[model samples]
Target: MQKKCTLITAAAGLVLALGAPVVGSLPAMAATAPTSSVAAAATTPELGSGGHVFAHGIVTLTSAVYDQGRISVEGVITERVRDVQINAGHGYQAGKVGAGGRFSASVASDSPTFELRFGTKYNAYNFATVESVLWSAVAPGTPPETPGPRPTLTPLPVPADPNPAPEPQPQPEQDAKQPGMPNVLAVSGTDGGWTNDFETGAVESLFTAYDHARREATVTRPTDGTLHVQQSSDGVTFTDRATYTAGGGIGKFTDIDVTLPEGSSWLEYKMWVEDSSGRKSEAQKFFVQEFPARN
Candidate 1:
């Protein structure tokens, strides 16, 4: 009976020890729940960009420049953004974020609203974050002023000459009379949007012929030898699509059954002029976007 009592006492001590472990494990599990929650909260990332105002009145915004609020998970930075886009006023620019997530864009005005976007890869994948900031909130600058139209000139009347000089004999036939304002409206060509250096000679009066029914895009240019028409869907990389040799000043290329991609609304056209003497003019690019439908 004494041996049975001693055994019962020892079993009670063992039960107490095991019971303490169970109680202790309860607190540990509760602690683990909070620790997991805290770990999850710690991994949540924050994204922001830095803006700088230059003395020349330009406001520059850069992504990944200042990484005060950036976050990392398991030592892997989650907010190292790749592509960055900035839109301000009428201008929109896009580029990839460089090392340290840095990409910069110039704002058009002071206190402008900048809509910034950050992505995970270069010009692909979904955006990681979208952010906006008012220029006034960061650095104050001036908005551009709208200049008035230029003044028109009035020609002075020449005094009547009592004896008008005889007209000189007409020289050899000159080049065809250039149009005062050519019917060919320039979308873009030499002396258009690209630049003003007519080093080789300007390829003027670039026009387009778009057949809505047939979905055709025709481009024309004047003062051409062989006009090379290049097309670009993204406006970045242009590929030479067709070449037309011109016998006269006017060079025209018809549809020839070239169509844009499905649901593609924007197209860019560029022209390169090559003369008989092998002289080539500077290339010019033109952007074409669809107009909104009328109500």
Candidate 2:
């Protein structure tokens, strides 16, 4: 069942994800975006030596450096992108998209991979983009260029759902799910948030869950890779939790049902995917805060 109770009910729950859909293997050079985009500009990621320059559409990555478990990257985007976020599981770094659409972000990670998310006002619903990247270390001696002159910061906008469509609705109770179960629910939250992570490429995953507690959280990318999971107590640190050995349904390998650990509140959990070979996807932070018992 989805976990939806909170000591205090949040203004509709906020679930954010940082990672791309799983891929069987990195592409040779660059390929097209996997998820078909409703917007003409959207593209699938192409991972390569170009400093993880996959989604070079609106926000583009140009350079990357890794030192002492820290991975740093630089890129440029249209001024529409207000800020850049680089999440590396254990730690994350944030930088603002400056004038001329230039920005840089760095983070510490046990691995040299991360999910890229940005904020901008020009897009509908304060539109943003998410990209998955595998970065390399900077060669000895040569210096990486920097975007001189500190960029100014702007507020990240989260569009208001003044009037959400009342079509597909969630169950009045939580949607409990067992590990490895397929999620066929067509639900979006009253105030759900989403991005194009690696799972279901280009496919928009709107929020969907009822009050307090849902166990079925799904990812659709990496249609063939075996799904493994990692758990975090503080949303920063994570550890090996479980793996899904069950295969997908007749033409679907995108089901990712999230199950909370015993004795744990959904609030204290953060999750990401790992392939059979140990390659991990970006971590998604979501919680269906349980509603307190009413008197």
Best by lDDT: 2
Q: What is the lDDT of residue 289 in candidate 2?
A: 31
Q: What is the per-residue lDDT of model 2 for residues 196-258, given as tens digits with 9 covering 90 to 100?
A: 222221222334322222223443212332222222222223223323322221121333344
lDDT of candidate 1 over 1-295, digit per residue (tens): 0000000001111122322321111110000111222123322111121223222211123211112222111111123444555554554466444553335544344332344434332223223332222322222222222359999999999999999999999763233323431122223233344332211112332343221111123432333322233332222222223333222222344334223321223345444444445554454544433222122
Residue pairs in clash, model 1:
none
What TM-score does candidate 2 get on C-alpha atoms? 0.28
For each candidate, give its TM-score against the true structure.
0.18, 0.28
Position 261, candidate 2: lDDT: 26
The stretch of ten residues in a row with the least summed lDDT in candidate 1 is 1-10
lDDT of 1: 0.31
The stretch of ten residues in a row with the least summed lDDT in candidate 2 is 1-10
